[model samples]
Target: MAWPTGASPYGIGVRDAVVRGVGPRSTDGVIRVWYPAHVPSSLAARRYFDGPDELQIMTRGLGWLLSARGVRALGGWRTRGHTNAPPAAGRLPVVFFSHGFTGFVGQNTHLCERLAAAGYLVISIAYPEAAASICAPDGSSNVMSAAQRRRLVGDQFARAMVRLLRARSIDAENRAISEVTAVDTLARENDRWSVHLTAMLDALVPIDQRRARVDTATAAILDAGDWSRVALMGMSFGGSTSANVAHLDERARAAINLDGMQQGDILLGQDIRVPLLVMSSAGSMLPSGRVVNDLHYESRRTATGRVQRVLVADAGHYAFSDLVAFGARRTRGLLDLGTVDPERMLTLVADTVTAFLGDALEPGGDSGTDETEVSP
Candidate 1:
């Protein structure tokens, strides 16, 4: 596997730890932090997951087809970051990241590393129940159970997708989106995830009482984070969660969604209070100049803060993920990794996101809707 290129003035340091559960409904989950650090010359880059954990996660679902040898080979991949290196001093802006459904915390470590190198504190959260594979601080591993998969994608989901894709009119499309959001099981699950994200934000912000729950090292890192200037970002279902959390949480300064359709409250008439940047894969939009699988239509109907939409040409849904670089050519082709060169795709996404965050986090604030297309 190839390491994704990142441009940064600061050396990156990463740490894996558990974030104590907040509130009555929340449960402990694994979290990895990538931040500017004082890496010594003698330190070495760390393996992707450092052990067999990667194989356990990668060898499920369609990934079951991957040979154990191939999966082990992937484990040999190294990250640019060193483990638990000394964090750089000073308060830095923070970005909270959530992974896609069935995705682990490391799904987009390249992006987290890039953001960290650029001098931000990046925290990636992993939900044990929702993730394909995740490990707690004590070394217990959790993989999504078979029953969980069936419940997540069973009959209710199939019917929703069919109605969502077949809607011919704007009203019909909105109606279909509403029905999908109304599904009790799915909606409850989305709410639970959103609460999980909120709990993370609560742990970071100094004013929140939950800060005491984090470990000493993590608390020190949090102490150096400018939580007042926070951003929420994620991919797929995680992206949708970011939008929802940003809408409800006044602490979030901005939100970014990578190739995910907005659902739940976001599609049901709630407006995101903070700025939102929705980066879509080429397939999400039609040549007719409309986004079919996203809240592009719904967002236009509901007034909100600045919303910028970017359509990446020659890209597929998974292009926004590390799979574009990690998977073999044949594997990528089978997974719809699109025609965009993997390196170029990473560069494009990182640069675009960094630029957007810079503007969105500016003091005075920004508003309005802007849509553009980029070919990498």
Candidate 2:
């Protein structure tokens, strides 16, 4: 399989493995895996979205959140993907991924596939109910509604949380969530993410070599992954989940947040135990935009563990996504996707993410992230 030019540094292959997450919220969803493929691509390339409807929903939903004028209509849309191919030889570094609020697992395919091309096994989980829509392997769809969302978080204030996401100022958003709901939301999502991390680990055991938990397709790629050496990463709400999981589980070698807002107890004086990299978008540096990033940086400002906060130039919240290049940007300047070139931004993000994970997961790569600095 082949990846886009700027998406990765190497050629990669992808496969879809269905794993039934065992625990409180046992979900049956697709875990998209991207790996370094030595085998040639004999089959057709994979579809980027589960279906055209999913693509439309993602494009429009993100537009509504990031674009004041809302997402422009989709005309001709295309995606870059190579899926369900044979696994590459040799076990590779494993990295787990999470999506943003009201976003699906496949929302950040470019980032996940880019890591795969860089010789890392990348897994992006399609969140059930939490996402606006989740596509299962059996050709069905699951969409989360506002009423359902509040239940997922075990709260009655789902509308308030949604309103907060649309708030123009950080102060407004901060004020939207009271101390009680803040803790409740964080604790619930943290438990959900923790369960996901543990379930992924459990799925790593070989089917014939162990008990029956994951499907055969998942078992095929499990042997080639190093469970001992794993990393947790996410975009948007997934970032909070990744941070929370990395904090609780020592197995997470590194944690990277791609323009994700911090969540849960971390806002209430919780320290991240593992190494963390906060890659903020250009807009995040703005006075009004700094609301979420400010809290994240403050949480680790006085900590002792390795934490590097780098601000990317000419980027916005959606820059971490493929929408910048793929979506129809009808109302330009209305959305703060990024001021810099989309490809350039993604290349930098992909490179920096790989470097941080490499240093943390590998021996003697570069454990020093002492100073909080901005990238050029």
Q: Which one is best on lDDT?
A: 1
lDDT of each: 0.75, 0.64
lDDT of 2 by residue, 1-376 (tens): 1224454445567766567544333335567778876545565545665456555555544444544233333212333445656676776888988887777776677778778877888888776667766555555556666675555454444665655666676666666544424556556766776676666656653345423555666666666887677888998778867877777777777787877756654544445677778877765553355534555433556564567677776577777866565444553344457566666766777777877887888854434565444444
* Residues 1-376 of candidate 1: C-alpha lDDT, one tens digit per residue: 5566665667889888776655332225578899999999998988876756545655552244346665566567787888888999977888989888777787787888888888888989986577766766666666677677566676787787678777777777767767777777778779889988987776667544435667788777767788778999999889889988887888999888998776675645445577888888877763334675455323454465478778987899888987777567787777778989988888888887887887887786663577778875
By TM-score, how accurate is candidate 2?
Answer: 0.77
Measured on C-alpha atoms, candidate 1 has an lDDT of: 0.75
List of clashing residue pairs for candidate 1: none
Q: In model 1, what lDDT does residue 342 have?
A: 86
Worst 10 residues of 1 by lDDT: 293-302
